[model samples]
Target: MKSHLIKDVGAKLMNRGHRAILAISGGRLLSAPFGMPTVELHTVGRKSGLPRSCYLTSPVHDGERIVLVASKGGDDRHPDWYRNLQATPDAEIVIEGVTRRVTARTATPAEKAELWPRIVASYRGYADYQKRTERDVPVVICENR
Candidate 1:
């Protein structure tokens, strides 16, 4: 199957919440080296009351929280999944072969100010992405449950 199709299947399986952890663990084993790999984030559709999944890079982590960026590669529009999270802060993240429930919130200005530099240091592409857009990209904190 194509990557997107595979991701969809994985997300659907995860939503069942049965053996999701096992699936995620397997994914981690398969995808690691190239910085934090992509994971399927299962979020609720703001209006549809159904699950939506998207592929996003896993950035740095602090304590129990994982950071994600809504960069969209500096595209003019924000990512759909980011918007969904804004509507409903509760979401599920599959990271490093583990699945966990998390509450998603945008970083506060102070938090962003502090965290953005760290992010750019770890992932240099972020700085280039910033230069491409007029609006500042948001850094989302996914606090684990």
Candidate 2:
């Protein structure tokens, strides 16, 4: 399937009925299906100046912060949500039915060096994704705003 199509459908499914399904299924529905927390990220479109959101899996969530990968399935281009966050760092993230305000920023080289191993350990696919593209995949850290 096309990436954008998958993204749009995923956002729609999560927004429309996935939450209810997750609740009814006792947290085993889609929660951490990928060994990571699923997060609904809310941001403002940089150009449109309108609300934009997408469901993403966070590879690391250590209570104080959540980590997102801008891998875009190794498509060689940054995801729209990633770009949005670049333009406007302020955002909201919904995890386990709780919403929190956050500020998003790309990890520094030092931070990435420290976090990359843990991130890859959480999901090996991310490492493969990184190898598939020339551009470096950005690791985004979101902390309470």
Candidate 3:
């Protein structure tokens, strides 16, 4: 949980590796052996104004809507995708093999308090990730755009 080179490097390696696989497999093998569903978040870069995407697990979704945790594996800083979404809420999400346009927003404090437990219940790692950081990790909700 503490700041350590191994954890930092491992996280980067895992993300990069997972991203590569997703690109190669065309979303068929997202997140590999993890049974939980993973989705591709497409956000316009805040700085470059270019399309960027990263994979994330959806701990909660209701057919038309999905919730993505900006936990950054509980790191102190927000993930780039989350930051980009803040600058440009217009985005896209690829669930399974279907891609759809979406508008994203960080959940309100009241909503975070309401959804936290349900998310943690779906994936225990999210709770552990929070313990590793000082900041309240953001929760992003992406609905049909």
Candidate 4:
């Protein structure tokens, strides 16, 4: 499938209302679609300078912090949101219907080493995603700003 198509479909399925169907509502979370926490990440468009948003799954989260994978479904290229965060790390995230400001940063090699196992444990697809591409899939850590 085309990259844009995958992103479009994913965005649609993960948005607020539809996400409720996947299991999160009014600060309460249940069993999510992939047994992960759902988050709406807001960022500035790197090229357009416009606000952009995408729904993502947090394979690791501790209420105050969130860890995201830039897997792009194992595509060779990084996802737009990942690039956006690289360009502008200041962002906002909404979890369980509550929004908060955050600073986004790519995990260091040591951090990745420690987090990788837990990440894959949360969702086995991450291991598959890493194996499917030659480039190292980055782990993004977002913490309250």
TM-score of each: 0.75, 0.83, 0.84, 0.82
Location of the lowest summed lDDT over 10 successive residues in candidate 2: 10-19
Report, for every candidate in turn, its global Cα lDDT versus the true structure: 0.76, 0.88, 0.85, 0.86
The residue ranges of model 3 lying beyond 4 angstroms of the native Cα positions read: 1-12, 23-34
Model 1 whole-model lDDT (C-alpha atoms): 0.76
Error of 1 at 102 (Å): 0.4
lDDT of 3 at 94: 82
Candidate 1 lDDT over residue span 1-145, tens digit each: 4754665566555445534543677654435433765566899988897998866666677559889988876755576788899999999988765788999999999999999888887788888888888988999999987
- Give the TM-score (vs. native) of candidate 1: 0.75
- List residue ranges in candidate 4 displaced over 4 A: 1-31
Model 1 / residue 94 / CA error / Å: 0.8
As a TM-score, model 4 comes out at 0.82
Residue 18 lDDT (model 2)? 61
Model 4 residue 134 CA deviation (Å) reads: 0.3
In order of lDDT, best first, we have 2, 4, 3, 1
- Candidate ranking (TM-score, best to worst): 3, 2, 4, 1
Backbone clash pairs for candidate 2 read none
Clashes of each: 2, 0, 0, 0
Better of 1 and 2 by lDDT: 2
